[model samples]
Target: MDPAGGCPHAVNARLRTRGAVAPVVLPGEVEGAVVLGHEALKDFLAHPDVAKDPRHFTALHEGRIAEGWPLRTFATVRGMTTADGADHRRLRSLVSRAFTTRRVAELRPDVEALTDRLLDGLEGAAAAGRGVADLRRHFAMPLPMGVIGELLGVDAEYRDRLHHLSSRVVATDLGPEEVLAANRELPALLGTIAAAKAAHPGDDLIGALIAAREEDGDRLAPEELIGTLVLMIVAGHETTLNLITNAVRALCAHRDQLALVRDGRAGWADVVEETLRWDAPVSYFPFRYPVRDLTVGGAVVRRGTPVLAGYSAAGRDPAAHGPDADRFDVTRSARPEAARHLSLGHGAHYCLGAPLARLEATVALERLFARFPELDIAVPEHALAPHAGFVGNSVRDLPVRLHP
Candidate 1:
């Protein structure tokens, strides 16, 4: 695949060779940057020289590069995604207070309860002789959103609107105007929530962020607060949904692996990790630009290059996971940290909601299979639809026969 061919974000895992740093084209680049993956992935993700935050781009401010095509579509705001170094540390530190070890532990009972409740609904649908249920919508979709909403202090009335914005923003198929319109509404909604939280503090993540103070007595600016909340809501809701959705599909697709877990031979943790490794939740997230010119993986990535991580393909790097890297095997042992999946990302930008996502997926998958017991895929393998965009690794729906 020519790096100069299309939107680098749309570069599918199937088209690019694993662990190979190929020169790929971004929308505006005359000469595209080297796309890093496979053997080059671990180092590149951990490299301190490369910055993830787009706000610090030297080329953008200096007008060295044209910012029309990709820049217009994605108006990245100032938040953790746009922060680096001290700013990142401070913002992440404040946010970390909301996801404390004790807080996460406290969430277990609620998560388990939510899982059982959703499963009960599924069981009820099966008992009523409906036979078929859209587990993607019924089970995988709602659980994470509900949990994250409660955690963030977002009201129930706002959930439907949030879902729509998330879908639109991640979609690669949306036209320019449609993309702008979606981006426009997202912050307005988050701002409304932020304002309410400010007026009436609640015992929730948003409130925690608002009240959190740094060692130097700094607070998250108003816009930063909204950006933080938006990040938490989107990542907390969507990625976890995909994680559960992908896991269910993977287990159903590989019945032998399902039997191992359902019959008690293997643990649910094995299924979650294996699924994260095999089918990543978010395929390719965003571009991380080089602060300056740097050579990576036998190629020169010039200064200000917009380089996105090939996250979905990194997990299957043959150098790390052996020749069977692409195969789904629940019994596989955990790989070394360096060679592990970049599904949830790596380094400072590594996903903060990872623990919650894992907990949600595990609890949901466990209760789901246990309650239904004989749940079977109602649709053909090809009938299931992958997410339309390159951003998320998800199916349109997972139709199942609960009583089968």
Candidate 2:
């Protein structure tokens, strides 16, 4: 697949015709394989021979991947995202305790309050003759940012800078120096936050992680602490931001489906699921290396070759979702046998923040529509550009009218 700057979904749709696992050109003209079939990608995710650690990646370990490679920032992280087996379990275990369902439940009030505040801000802007608002900037972006920031004990003062640095980490269009700069700045910022939390601990996730020590004298190392926080903030913030943005965009485009939600024919949960299946928030995730040479979808992937899990492509795979997979239907998930979308991920590395993301999106969408049922896109759908980089899927901005 060529790296054209148009809609990634369209490119992926053509790739699907090639087979389940298709070769593609990533940014920086890098060669990689993307798993396009739904079942094929699922197997790729949970396969024992597949791995997340960069050490197993041949190109990265052999110095073929340069320090300034656009995607190098992602593959080289020391976080739980790059850990394997026991180490992965240990790191995930430490943080999993903090992201408990009850904890997510407790955050609902904060999410609701934040959602209301953002909607109020949007209403004020619309009434002030602004005529339109970038929901992505004013609403979709901040809701999760505020929630994760609150959860991590990060001050509001640091939220904007943290997000800017985090955006650079996923941007494939950035130059080597820019990528390198962000690579340095993000962890440094997280470290500063970690150090400050160390000086004054609070009942937040970062504080808990700082104070956590396992029974066998295991504790998060210095780098692991920063890496874990980066993962929590970046992954936690970006994925949900796109999910909310994509859901709103899809509902606007398919008002008939939105009408289903309005008439009580479908719930907001269905809207969330349909948007996930039709236009997943994460287009493709990088750098899953095969420990041994493996065959996927009739393609032989060499051992140690980097494989990308095409979550967005697989979500709409015709083989898995049938011929009408591309169609966005709010009632699809209501079927007892409907397939679950992997937008949040699967297997041992499934997103720890899934519950929180779902909660935020559901609450955000429900409250957003309730507050402004006449909400509509301010610009043509075709005019909206995709988010930079392949890792996070979303429009650059969601311009919408709070009134007519």
Candidate 3:
């Protein structure tokens, strides 16, 4: 069946036209390839043969490390992103308790309060000038930093520095020397935070991790602790920042849906979900290598083959999402089974912070609309600055007019 041209496919076509290469899909599939590389993408994500080590993908590895960014230390082994099997389980187990539904719900009040504060700052900025502001700077960027900073025990004073370090590290265009610098310096920074959390334990995630390390004994190494903390701070902030920006951009592009959300006729949560599906912040995850030879979709995947799963492509598959899959309709009730948008990922490597991400987006969107009832784009949509590369995609700046 032919797609009516919406969401993922529409975006995928743009990417393809811009020189992004993907596997060729068969006739029946909506995308170029249903079984990208060797097997179905979902199967590859579930396969134990497929490992998350970026080292297997030589080009990506060299490209990221070529730069001397200090945050690379955390990226190389920090958190659950690189871990597989028992190590993945151990790291996930340690932090799993902190991201529970109850915890996310408990944090809603704080999220709302933080959202309000951010809007207050944006309002002040806009009022002082032309009643216009860059949503990325004033709203999207800082909200996640504030929320995740408090969550990870990063000192309030150092949030800006951490944000700078994180941005440089994950930046796709960085050279090897720049990436290496970030990889090296991140540990010392995180080490200082770990010490502070150790000395004066707080009710934050870092403090909890330190306690867990001390009580468990050998459960988590010092490097692992630094890595996990870095992961939480960096990943938590960058991804959420993009998610907020993408959501706003999508709503603005679809005026009717934006009006629906603004008028309170549609559920904000559903709108957020659709936004994630429509223009996900993290477009594609890095390749996972196979530990052994495997056959997928009649193709042979040799050992150590790198497989890149297309989240952007999968979410927009017309076969899975119906003809209007690409349309941003807040009233559209997404099926749980069909909602398997690769945005949060799949299988064992699924995102640990999904619940928290949803909570933040829901709170942020509701507060944003409620505050700036007359918010609209200040610049032409095509003029928006977008961060390019395979790791993450987001608007660099979102200039918008806010009417009180």
Candidate 4:
């Protein structure tokens, strides 16, 4: 947990305890260190020259290569979010059309229906003398998985396997050999799904992607197709899962806010937005390296220095969010204001599933609170297990008692 130890993203706990923004400096006495905050970090993310390709950082690349991780395969290159220039534009445009606000709006009915069904299952379990249930397993995890799986045409039977594959792919602390093993295994599994979709066309994202590939004739590469599918599944499930669990926990801790949500005085949508700001599901974007030498907050970031934008820190920036930035205010009117938080990221690589994530969270919260108005945490917050070095900060299990 030492700030100066392994992860550069780790801030000094002592500095945080002092109630101030932690400064991130370059090694040695650099003239200007990156002063990360809402405004400064926003400028950094908005800067056209602050790129995302990891190849910009030769040292990081060499380190990974020395560790036996694949440098140019699905681990890095094939992923659409990592691409730049014409490639990034082309892929993003194609994918954006599918995730348009209109398209996501159409999926809202299905999201609500799925939420209702999950709530029914939870109610049944509660009635059967199972006084408490892990909301993480019963609701948070499955709701997003089902929605995303339907979008991608992944079979219900294989959804569990896909979830397992996603966990392996995004693991940060895994050794080089372990990461490589995941890289090898993911494609084979996805290849099977791709072949199935190719043989049997269906009304799903994967089918649409396959059709697009066929019509375009080499425009959409096989690796790109599979990687996009994997990204959608992983991105869709992991973030929203945490959003639901975190929102529920936040509500439990604040009974007044829960009452507001239950009585419809405050919309559940506000709760969802506030929860995202309070404790974001995806704490940081994957490592982004500068393509050219750049200055952020007066710090000279050489071309090829790795930078991880701190979304968690940015969410709590006092200037952007006011002095009470740490307070979770569901009634806060500025929730939708632009530059609120980098949870969905900024610029071209911004999350493609933002609309769907919002829809799922809204629907999940509406149904959950309506069903169990007296829901309470089964264990103290500190007792819960935390997911470590993962894309989302998820509770390993969220046990809650549902009072009928």
lDDT, candidates in the order shown:
0.74, 0.87, 0.70, 0.70
Off by over 4 Å in 4: 1-36, 60-77, 126-129, 213-218, 334-339
The residue-by-residue lDDT of candidate 3 on 208-272, one tens digit each, is: 88877523465577878888877887778889898998888887778789887668788889887
Worst 10 residues of 1 by lDDT: 1-10
Ranking by TM-score: 2, 1, 4, 3
Q: Which portions of model 2 miss their true places by more than 4 Å?
A: 1-5
Candidate 1 lDDT by residue in tens digits, 86-181: 888888887775576677778999999988888878666656646787887778878999899998889989987898787776676555677678
- TM-score for all predictions? 0.89, 0.97, 0.85, 0.87
RMSD versus native structure for model 2:
1.3
Specify the highest-TM-score model's number.
2
Q: Give the per-residue lDDT of model 2 (tens digit) for 208-246.
A: 999988789988899889889889889878888999999
Query: Which ten-residue region of model 3 has the weakest summed lDDT?
Result: 25-34
Displacement of residue 94 (Cα, Å) in model 2 is: 1.3
Clashing pairs in 2: none
Clashes within 3 Å, all models in order: 4, 0, 36, 0
- Candidate 1 vs candidate 4: the TM-score winner is 1
**In model 3, what is the error at residue 147, expressed in angstroms?**
1.3
Residue pairs with backbone overlap in model 4 = none
lDDT ranking, best first: 2, 1, 4, 3
